[model samples]
Target: MIELDGVSFWYRGRPDPVFADVSLSIGEGELVLFAGRTGAGKSTLLGTVNGLVPHFTGGHLEGAVSVAGQRTDEHPPREFAHLVGVVGQDPLAGFVTDTVEEELAYGMEQLGLAPQVMRRRVEETLDLLGIAELRRRPLRTLSGGQQQRVAIGSVLTTHPKVLVLDEPTSALDPTAAEDVLATLARLVHDLGTTVLMAEHRMERVVPFVDRVVHVPGDGGVVDGAPAAVLRTMPIAPPIVQLGKLAGWDPLPLSVRDARRLAGPLRADLPAPAQPEAHAGAEVLTASGVVVTYGQTVAVRAVDLRLRAGEVLAMMGRNGSGKSSLLWAVQGSGPRRSGRVRVAGVDPKELPAAEARAVVGLVPQTASDLLYLETVGAECAAADAESAADPGRCRALLDRIAPGIAAGKHPRDLSEGQRLALVLAIQLTAAPRVMLLDEPTRGLDYTAKAALSGVLRDLARDGHAIVVATHDVEFVATTADRAIVMAEGEIVTDGPAREVLGSSPAFATQVAKILGEPWTTVAEVAAAVDASAGRVR
Candidate 1:
């Protein structure tokens, strides 16, 4: 369905080609996942498939590229829309209508489909994407995941044979991302639609893919089966590492495959390490915290408390008030009621700057703070208020991102490295309380581990950390406690394992699946191992 032959593209005024001598092909009814570290030309390659690279991006291109046997260079975006559908990273940026039904039908209307046909297609897409309940909802009112599903429905209405997505799940929590991916998988398996997608999170996509295409950082093409190509890459998922250590040929790409190959090895493997709990004092407390944005109650009479040296994870579906609660605690949200104290000082009366002085926030888009000319300067500037040691700043920066040069401009670095730089800067403050909003988003497994190490170190040093996120795997691995919220209210709050085990929607997918009263993969794994004499 798609082909690229010796394709090379360079943006105007850019010194070098963003992609060079690239060659790849995607057949009809095949699912291809285009993956690499950010800015490795994954998105740019997808753009070329739909004629965006040479036309929309104002770039010089050489060689031939075609989709559905139509030459991309000869076709405008509008003409190719019938053959290819591209869903971008930011769905909100592409929204052109107010309601979900209208958004889904807009493309069909633009194509001049009959009214009956448009209506039928809209209904089918809404149902196909599991967004029927959201048909009448305003686009702005929908959560990030719902909005993305709507965006996909908008494209699918055209019934294009090939679908291309650029990190559709990057902005979504685990459950939401899974929903979207599940829909796409259904389209590929049941409907026989061709799928090509680029994603930074390999753990989610590795199992679903038949093959992997790696875009080289220095501008080239790397492609092979998911197993063969993943081994040659410097970055890989944990299951991939486990497969390597166990000496499995054509190393398993998913946890299930790894587990199957791990039968004998599991018996000899060391017991999972337990994180030492800090017997420390409370550092923050919120009683009856109610925050409302106009009529929308984001945190409805919620109560929470943080203790020193504890890693607390706040989880829920997208727009379930996770970020809102974090903002309330940070003193940066809309009007907040009830008592909120950081280190026993009420935050409502305290200036945001003062509250932040005691609690540092590692925001979701921390990379936006990177405007400095060089990496070293950005880290030092973030700590301008305190007489922070230069050596300490360098040490922290190197710890999270030893791959990047400190002398290079932050903008010149890849997206993941830029985020790591911001995280390193946030740690320099040494705040007693740290608030992180989806810190693992857009990060690869290696980077995720690096950031986790930093957070673990801080927690060991007596910093109370609260992470508002939808990454359940991350919570299972890192958090000491878990808080569940739904419809802007706390649904469950307790030990991390208990809360996760009790979540029906989330429990089945856990690495260590369990029934009621068991809330974590570790617990289920332990139970199974003990029964099988696999516990070491």
Candidate 2:
């Protein structure tokens, strides 16, 4: 239903095209995944389907692109709205209405559908994406994951022939992501809708995708079955990487397949070494933390503590108070009742600038912290505000996410690039306590690895870090401690491996295939190497 004939695209003043000579086709009812490193033109490719590339984005296009018999070049994005439903990475930027129900119905209303038809589709979409409970909630009040679901439901209600989503499940928790992906699978199988998605978290989508399209950042595209394409792809899901490491032929794409071939390898591997405990002094303490939005209690009275050199991961279902707790602790969001003390000072009583020095926060919407035009300006401003070295912020940006142009506008950056910029700005402050909410939303595995290393180094440098996230793989690799929250309360707190391995919903692919104490592929690979060394 979708075809690209020798398509080459480039931005103004750039000599090299983002992608070149990309001739591809997607059969009707096919669920195709676009896999690549961050800023490797995955999102740019998705935009071409809905005519947002050359038309709205002001880029040069060569060759023809058509979807469902409509040429994107001939028609504008709005004209193809009936044929394509596109969801960008940042959902909040696309929202036009206040409440969940209204946003879901807005697309249909624009299509001039009958009131009854719009209402029926709205209800069906709400149920399909599992957002029926959020129908009455205001859009601003919902969590990032909730907003992501609402954004997808709004597009799904239109019932377009082709659905194009960029990082659809990036903000969702594990359970919610499965629900959304399962719903997409149903659409492909039962309703014959075509889905073209770009996601960094490949583990969740690899099993469900009918085909894989790998973009290798060299202005080329590789397309084939999952196993065929993953063999040479630089980045891969944990299951695929494990299969490769174990020398399993026809690399497994799912946990079930990996487990079937893991018996001998599991036997050969030694138990993973236990993580060392953090013995640093207490840096922050909070008690009776309560955050409320009128009748809604986002964060119940809770007590928490953080040491000087610890990385704590706060995890839970969407809208389960992770973000609320983070915001309250940072003294930015509503805290009806709470006392947060950092370095013997109450941040809530300090000015915003002073509070940031005491406790820095990189919010879920990382772009909110970036207002400067160019990346260089933002870094310069961050350095000036923090009274740091002139080039400190830029150096941090390079360390976190390399290759970002200093002159590029922050608004024009990819989601992952923007997130990295915000992180660099926050780190320049050198706050004693750092809090990040969903920091890995758009980062590729490589970028995430860089971030994980940065966090580890910061912890070693006597910085206390708390990350509120849904990326279980990230938590497994980065966090030293894990705290599971539910309905405005902390329900479980323990070592990261203990907490992640114990929960089936949050376990990593390696842990599932190789069993407990093996939550990351790196650790497993290390154990395998150790066993081999001993035998030699």
Candidate 3:
């Protein structure tokens, strides 16, 4: 369904091609997965299929690219809308309508689909994507995850032969991610719809794919059987690592496969190490926190307290008030009634500079914090604002994610790289309390590990940290405590292991495979080593 021959593309700029001498073919009814580190041109490749690369994006394209027997270069993106359905990373940016129902039907209307056909397809897509309940909700008011569902539904209603999704599940909860992937699987198997997906979270999509297209950092591509490719990939999911450690003949990609081999390993391994509780004096406190917009209450009365060295994770569905509470605590977002004290002062009452010194927040849209023309300029501005050394912000950015070009525009950076840049800027303030909302949205495993290390070190330095995220793996690795919120109320709060282990929706792959409370591969690996020592 998709073919590229000697295809190479590079933006009109100073240097280098994004892809050079690349050739690939994806057959009809096949589910292909594109895997690579962040900013490795994965999205650029996906764009080429629908002619968004050189056509809409203003890049130079060489060689032939075709989808459904139509040359992409010969046709505009709209010309192939009936054949190719593309959903990008930021669903909100692509929205043209205010309500979910209208957004879904808008594409069909453009195609001049008959009203009866459009109505039936809209209903089918809404049901297919499990977004029926959200039909009448305004697009602007929906959470990130809900917006993603609506984006996918908008394209699926057209019954396009090809579907290209970029990180479709990044904003979704685990359950929602699974449901969407399962629906895609059915489309590939039952409807013969060709699907191509690019995702950083390999564990979720790798198992279900028929082919894996591995894109190494050198602007190249390699394709092979999923097992063969994943085995050699430097970055892999936890289960793959577990299989490597245990010397399993074939590495397991899914929890079920790993669980089959986990029987003996689970019994032989010792108890996993537990993080020590934080007993330091509270560095941040929020009492009776309530946030409302118009008639809608985003957050109800909720109380929260954080110790200096605590790593607290706020977990909940999208729009569960996690972001509201974090923003309120940071003394920036609207709060109807609440008292927040950080470092012995209410940040809300302090001057802007003083409040920033007391608390730091890296919001969901990390790019909002960046306004300079280039990375170097942004770093210089951060240093100037914090009154730190000229190179301090640059140094921090290097530590977070190395090798970012200082001359490149912040807007040009990949989602993950932009996030790292913003995070570095926020860290320069050296606030006593820090809050990050959905920081892992675009990060790969390697970047996430680096972020976890950074956050863990900050916690050790007695910085109170609160992270509101859907990345359970990140929470399991970084957070010492977990707080579950629902409709603005704290439902469960306890040790990270206990909270993540008991809930099926929030448990990590290790916890699921072991059928126990362990939350990470490190914990399991440590237990196995201890068991080996005892046996010896």
Q: After superposing candidate 1 on the true structure, give the runs of residues whose Cα lies further than 4 Å from its correct spot.
A: 11-16, 254-259, 269-273, 365-380, 385-418, 421-425, 497-510, 513-536
Which lDDT tens digits does candidate 1 get at residues 298-415?
Answer: 7799889889989999888777888778877877665468777888786656776676568878776576667779887886776674357766666776776675666777765555
Candidate 2 lDDT (Cα, 0 to 1) = 0.92
Stretches of candidate 3 exceeding 4 Å from the true structure: 533-536
Q: After superposition, how far is residue 335 of candidate 3 from its true place, in Å?
A: 1.1
Work out the TM-score per prediction.
0.85, 0.98, 0.97
**Residue 270 lDDT (model 1):** 46
Give the whole-model CA lDDT for all candidates, comma-separated: 0.76, 0.92, 0.88
Tell me the tens digit of each residue's lDDT in model 3 across 149-203. Answer: 8999898888899999999988887888888999999999999999999998887
Looking at model 3, the pairs that clash are none
Instruction: Order the numbered candidates by TM-score, best leading.
Output: 2, 3, 1
